[model samples]
Target chain A: MKTFKLGGVHPPENKLSQSAAIEVLPLPETVTIPLSQHLGVPANPVVKKGDSVKAGQLIAKGEAFISANIHSSVSGTVQKIDDVVDTSGYRKKAIVIKVEGDIWEDGIDLSKDLVKDISLSPQEIVSRVNEKGIVGMGGATFPSHVKLMVPQGKTADVLIINGVECEPYLTSDHRLMLEKAEEMLVGIQIQMKALNVDRAIIGVENNKPDAIDHLMKLIPEYPGISVEPLKVKYPQGGEKQLIKALVNREVPSGKLPIEVGCVVHNVGTSFAVYEAVQKNKPLVERVVTVTGKGVKEPSNFVARIGTPIANLIEAAGGIPENTGKVINGGPMMGKALSDINAPVTKGTSGILLFPQAETSRKPVHNCIRCGRCASICPMGLEPYLLAVLASHKRFDDCETEKVMDCIECGSCLYICPSGRPLLDQIRVGKNETGKMIRLRNR
Target chain B: MNEITLISVISLGSLGTIAAIILYMVAQKFKVIEDPRIDIVADKLPGANCGGCGLAGCRALAEEIVKKESLEGMSCPPGGNEVMGEIAKVLGLEAKEQDPTIAVVRCSGSRENAPPKVKYEGDMTCAFAHNLFAGEGGCPKGCLSYGDCVASCDFDAMYMDHKTGLPVIKDNCVSCGACVKACPRSIIEIRKRGKKDRRIFVSCINVEKGGVARKNCQVACIGCGKCVKECKFDAITLENNLAYIDFNKCTLCRKCPPVCPTNAIHELNFPPRRQRPETKAEPAEA
Candidate 1:
């Protein structure tokens, strides 16, 4: 089993939803589709009040090269377009639609037939993925179309598919691989075709032998595709870490996976790409894992883009009375949602609820000079020093220490003996340092 | 040994004398002529380097005052008029008196007035909360209740009231504007301290429409323009679905708060009002 060379932690694998088969969540009566779902400039809404929109209709268009288009997830009358509180606890412009029926767009293929024929050319595949507004479903939500366009002077040699749901309680990708193995392989082929790569590898943690076995058995039909079992470790699913695990290549600091002649995509993203290229479907719905110790029933649901998380909780056996915190993703990297009414976005991979006992964040203490944070940082940067510099507003020093390279895996904060919030402080540093770097570049 | 001691003493004496004369000559050549009144003015000014006057320190400000020979724009916020009066007396210059000001929180979204719709569980600092959510209440433009202003106050002049979840400024506040700069949501305003400390200000910063703003907080200013119409001094203006009263133009007639349908205006330190006017009561008795 291969793993990244740098430091990592072994958080307990709380796979409560591993056995829960994916259930299709019923369409919400009203869907609030935020325009700025992806990690770029927000899309401009094309529809206004009283406009009748069908499912998969382009409600907002992504005009910027790095943005993703937002589509309506239900056929409904446009109730209103207004700012609604999203997962980030901030108000953002979103299209609100009251569902009237299940009418999809004229061009979208709603059938679930497995179409394996790759009829689209490489250029056509790229353009279709772009039009479908496909994004990295592994939680970063970077516009998939932008990643497909390999910059000049760079060559993508191999494609790495991330199947490692290394976060403690997440099993969405695990379920995605097992339930849709054939579709994923075909999706990988589509991604490979789009990237113009010869070889592709699916990196799965050894803890998930069933998924690996399933993919391994299905790989015979697909040439030049391999499944590599990785050492079961937290953050093994990180793009850089996964690349280093499978291909023995390290993505240089501040550079992308392309620096090492590779491009990484989530298994979910691969499936989305296949659907977009072969089925003419836009990226709309995804598999979300709602599980925790406090949850009544941990389960996975095939949720639409604008489904209210409250509905998922009700489906998963209503939110427990003692539940004190509701997170948007896995325990290690997810954000605490202020309201359960928040709608799931392209990046929401899991929703974890914790009881009052488990939600008690340890009181922050002074650094004890134990050097645990430095030893456990996956980026090989000193988180202890970064925390100190960021707290002091020394952004220049933070930039010099390479704070922007931090992947925010929460590994350092998790392992710190003194309960220092290294990741929290480093987030501030990264923001300030990124702004300073941008200003300097200009 | 005796002869050597005498000879060394005489040589050292001559060398010391020569070095002392050279040092004196250098000191005289590089002597910096400065106004003696700078030190006197600095002594009269408080030494707190709060930077409220936009200068480095009191000593630096003294030098600027002595150089400019004018106190047109140099008012020590911490020491206020008394210190400036003393400085002016020493410099033989007419000192301009400026009114004292203090920071007042413009939002009244207390726990009772504006109930929290959601709970904030992250960093308890107002700045972090301002970026994270619109407070627990749906008012994105109001106080975050995290007391960032309280934390930024170097004078220990602000504190968070647990019952109300709002910051209360102490009387010792020097009007230094530290809290103003510290607030991420710009909820704290430094307004002119009125006669007998009586002042009025709208206590809501929610810029949402009347319906939306009222939906979030019971006392949110709806910008209904009732206060604007009632203000006889033409001190109020409505913009962006929010009403702002100019303190400079406001005569403190105490009319706007009574006309505010939502009771969004706050009155501070005003005497109690009688049921009827004294003239009318006297005439009725007669």
Candidate 2:
């Protein structure tokens, strides 16, 4: 099986929610939508506190070039606009709504039937996706419109749909591929049209054999679309890693996948894009997996954008008695929520509840110099050296070692038997060094 | 010696001397003009090259000063006030006097207050803890108790207190602020060292509610607003369930110590007062 030439670690594939079908979660009485959902800038609030908003209505608009728009997940009256704590423990301005009815926007075509063809121009499709606030649902929440906007002088040769649900214990993408195969195919075609790419590949991990077969069967109707079964691997969904795994090309450091003549989209993102372009439906809901040993029930559900995590946990039969941590995503890179009231945003993939026994509790010991972390780092960085430099307050030295390149995948942390937190210190070094560089430039 | 040999030797010698003199004259005439004040300022600097002042070295700083029109917050750490004053005099500029400060870790959550949830047996670094988890302890905001602060202390003023699992500042602390930069939690702060090394600060960084903060560390600031109410000078502001004391408005009245519910606010350097005056006096009159 061909994998990315760089380092990767295969931990146990604890995919507990693989068989769980997507169920619509019960709408909460109130929803709190935060403005900063996408990667770049925080969106500006467009609706006033007393205004009534329908499902898929534009609630917030991007204030900067790199930001994405935000939409109302449900028809509701604006209860309040106030600062709310997010999963990361930071307070951000959020829109609170008291749901009035299941009234959707009149323009949105809420049809169960899949629309195969979209007559909209490529630019119009991109604009619709942007207006609908469709971001990449593969956990990064990058603005979809921005990704679709190929930079000037650059062209996308191949569009790759990432069906590789590589992160262990998370099957949201897997279920999306299995259940929404046709929608995904249509979405892939839509993406191909947007990128003006003739050829497209949907890379699914062999673990989801059924999804591969389904996609392969449906892809024949679309001439340029094909499904390729990828060997299951952790972080195979990373844009660079997936591109390399699927196409045998390496995206150079600090370069986009497009630079290597490819564009990768997550399966869920493709489905959302399909809906956005075809039916004029905005992205308001996403599949979320609630799974772990600490939860009584492990399942996947189509969760609304602004639902609180505590409600999701309650729907999953509540946390067990000895739940040690409540992570907002997969165990490897997910943030442990300090506030259960933090609402779900666009990029949340899963809610992992780990029992105290299953949680990692190793003390920071001396580096055995095993070099395992460096061996498995996909970015080809020496995490040990960066850790040492950061430890000694040699931030400049850390910068010289290019510590900023760490993707915070938690591979180094997961592989380190000595329990050293290489990512934590490296993140600080990156931020501090960036600030220093900025100060120097000023 | 033969006449020819002597002539050759004298000719070579004269040629060498003339070339040396010409080189010397050229070196003097075409010398690159440099500001003499830069040298004077550089001489007055401590030359530790710590780069804390955002410059490369003492020479770079001197050059920048000579080139710039104004100097503000541009004092070197190793030079201290005396050296800064000297440099200021040399440059024909007035030096601004700043309060000498040192970094003091407020959180006493060493092993006793904030117990470690897991034994981190990897690289001993606060940065590692910050990235991997929020910290080593149960509190997401608590200090990692790693020696990143100690490592950043170029003056050797801060050291890890083995028993407390916290960095202790010594009298020799120069307030260089390298430790502040190194600390991932931003717990290490540069504050004025009150008379006789007395000072006050909030020890805990936990902004979680009282119960939750207490669950993580015994000394976390729960943002109960008690300190804000107790302060007579209106020096404190509570936001995001965290209390911030504005040092400029703080009167050092020690009014907040008793009011803090969680002992998150710390007071140091105040004289201990006796309950009662001594009534008896030594036999004086003969």
- Tens digits of lDDT, candidate 2, A1-442: 6667788888888888888899889999899999998899999999998999999899999968888888999898999887676776655789998988889998889889988867989998888888888888988889988889899999899998888888889999989988988888889889889999999988887888888787777877998988888887777888888899989998886678889999988899999998888888888999999999767779998988999989999999987898777889887778777667789999999999888787656777888999999999988999888877765558788777877677778788789888887777677677777777778889
Candidate 2 overall lDDT versus native: 0.82
lDDT per residue, candidate 1, A33-64, as tens digits? 99988999999999999999988888999999
| Reproduced native contacts, each prediction | 0.35, 0.23
Best by lDDT: 1
Measured against the native two-chain assembly using Cα atoms, what DockQ does each of the candidate structures obtain, in the order listed? 0.35, 0.18
Task: Compose the digit string of candidate 2's lDDT tens values, residues B1-286.
Answer: 9999999999999999999999999999999988888888888787877776778888999888878834676867666778878777777788898666667886778898887765553446676556555454567677778888888777778788899888888888777778887777788887877666778788877766666667667777777787888888988889877788777778788877767766778877687745433323222111
Chain A (alone) TM-scores for all candidate structures: 0.99, 0.97
Q: In model 1 chain A, which range of ten residues has the least summed lDDT?
A: A420-429
Query: What docking grade does candidate 1 earn?
Result: acceptable
